[model samples]
Target: MYKIAPRISQLTVRQVEQFRSASAWVNPSRSRTESGPEASIDAEKLFINPEVQQLLVELTGMDLEGKVFRARRTTMQQRSHFALMTDERLSETMDKMRREAQRFLSFIPLKEPRSEEVTILSKDDDIKAFDNSKFVFTDITFDATDQDRTVVVREVDGTLRTATPEEHDRMNRVYYEKPNRPVFPPPVFKDPYLQDALARKEHEFVLDWACWFYEPDDPAYVNLVQCVCDRTVDNNDFEVLHSTRHFATLVFYLALNGNIPPLLNYFGGQGRIRDCANLVRLQKRLLPNWRFAISTSDTDLKIVTDFVKQNSRFHEALKDLIAFLKDGVILSRASPKVGSSFSAKAVPKVHISSLLISAFYS
Candidate 1:
């Protein structure tokens, strides 16, 4: 006789919890029930993965060697302001970017959410009557918004707690089915299909759809996005991202995992030295104890040098980056300002990049 798998509903309480724990990757740092905008950073699944580190090294080498630098398909105001606008506009853009970056980096909460005590169901006579199955209850009131809907679950062991995002979504679909959301998750979110979509450069499409389909805090959403993000790093396909929205999120994810060297290399290769410095500033902001010497007066080039010298991770691609920075300095000095209104004779002394320095310092 062939062995058969037991149905999930028939599993014992401890067995069910074990299976859930095994299948779902929960962020231990946050509440399992709370929903929020920020996705959990799974360090083990990302930077700690051997494949990911190898890919980062490869991308850094390519970028530092000037082999992967190309004109971006889309324009980013903050990155393009130096060539596209007057000094005043450039300064304003940089200031806005700096404030935004600071806000994003400063909100790191190390404290996890406090777990709530379970409320026993009053309807259960002995409390052991329905111990064999988990019961879920949802607020079906007409005015209840899906996002604000109250969904709770009573586990097989008689423990009552707020339903997880996945469970909450399921309950919402059952009561108020949206035309776009399916009863079950789409197959595209898994395995070969996701890899195929990423390879085709449909990252933006996939991410947009994921935002629409799953709540920001949904485990499915988090997993899908991070998987896509890891692939982007692996392929060094930043250009395919097309806009600043997801790009900033990607940068934040990298910084969260202490992996910014490849991103630095990419910016340096693209001749965006200010962007490189901004990235280093972001790193320092995230890690307060970084102990790097930086000030408003320090050139962006110097800031990048500080990162390279202190972080041993930068050793592998150091020579190429240094050479690129040197060439950038020389080229900036020799070439006339391409789009600035200033006369050739009135051009200010050249820095490593056309980046506005004061904003990053702030």
Candidate 2:
């Protein structure tokens, strides 16, 4: 299958939230219903598969031991501040990245934002205005969320719980999902058609945050998401969408707020945070045909060109990053997510990715 193909960002607010809100609690080793308690091994189908883990490792060299490190490059502010060196600097770069990841794990596990970190765009006393005309708009500000969003949690004994008012405030303020994004179904299969499509034209990337549920061949059982996309961009070209079920990232701030817990998705939340971090990937790369973004506004391309032109080093670095991401997916297609053994290893500093770009994977 073509790892990355032409794409169009066009899913609605509810649609994106549905994926975020999807609660699949099935333990493959156990016979529990989606509602019952599951053993600590069933993956969320999209985010916990072996294929997904391998992809994460290849792309970021991540060990998937979320005890730390997703903090550095996953946030908007942190992302805008990153720059890569030539391969010659790879060692030094990796060293610096290791320190950052360690700090993320040892000192500051991604936590909820301080009161000073959040800025309310609207006045609290007066109103609530939203756009529902098209795309079920929930957030007007870029990457921001509706003021009244709530959070759900999986309790200690395997029962699902809605956060109390205090927890809700913290949850909503951090890694909250918004409707400003447009989603598209990209063709992820490595087939002659995709090869042909790419040979004809290169693809544009807009990295978006996502978590996969099933391996490539599994039916995946999430009929809600399937039905929604089938209505818009279904043509048996779902290479990207399927992989999304398993790729996880910091979904908001530079902190580890709502990121999907690797094992929770796999083991059904053994007192782990439901969604893991607060960093958002633009969730852009998850969407397709991002080149259209430049067509509508050259500003996007100009920003990239300017950044790339800063030096040959940066230009080359960007190219290498893209190539690595593209190659990672291609490599992953061959090692389906099924055979991975949940029993595993937790590691030291080396888990940091040589690529510090946003943990943004397609």
Q: What's each prediction's TM-score? A: 0.56, 0.20
Candidate 1 lDDT tens digits, 234-324: 7666655523235545665665545666667656555656767776666455434455667979877788766665655465644335545
Candidate 1: give the clashing pairs: none
Error of 2 at 76 (Å): 14
Candidate 2 minimal-lDDT segment of 10 residues:
270-279
TM-score of 2: 0.20
Q: What is the C-alpha RMSD of each candidate to the true structure, in Å?
A: 14.1, 23.8
Using lDDT, give the best candidate's number: 1
- lDDT by candidate, in order shown: 0.53, 0.27
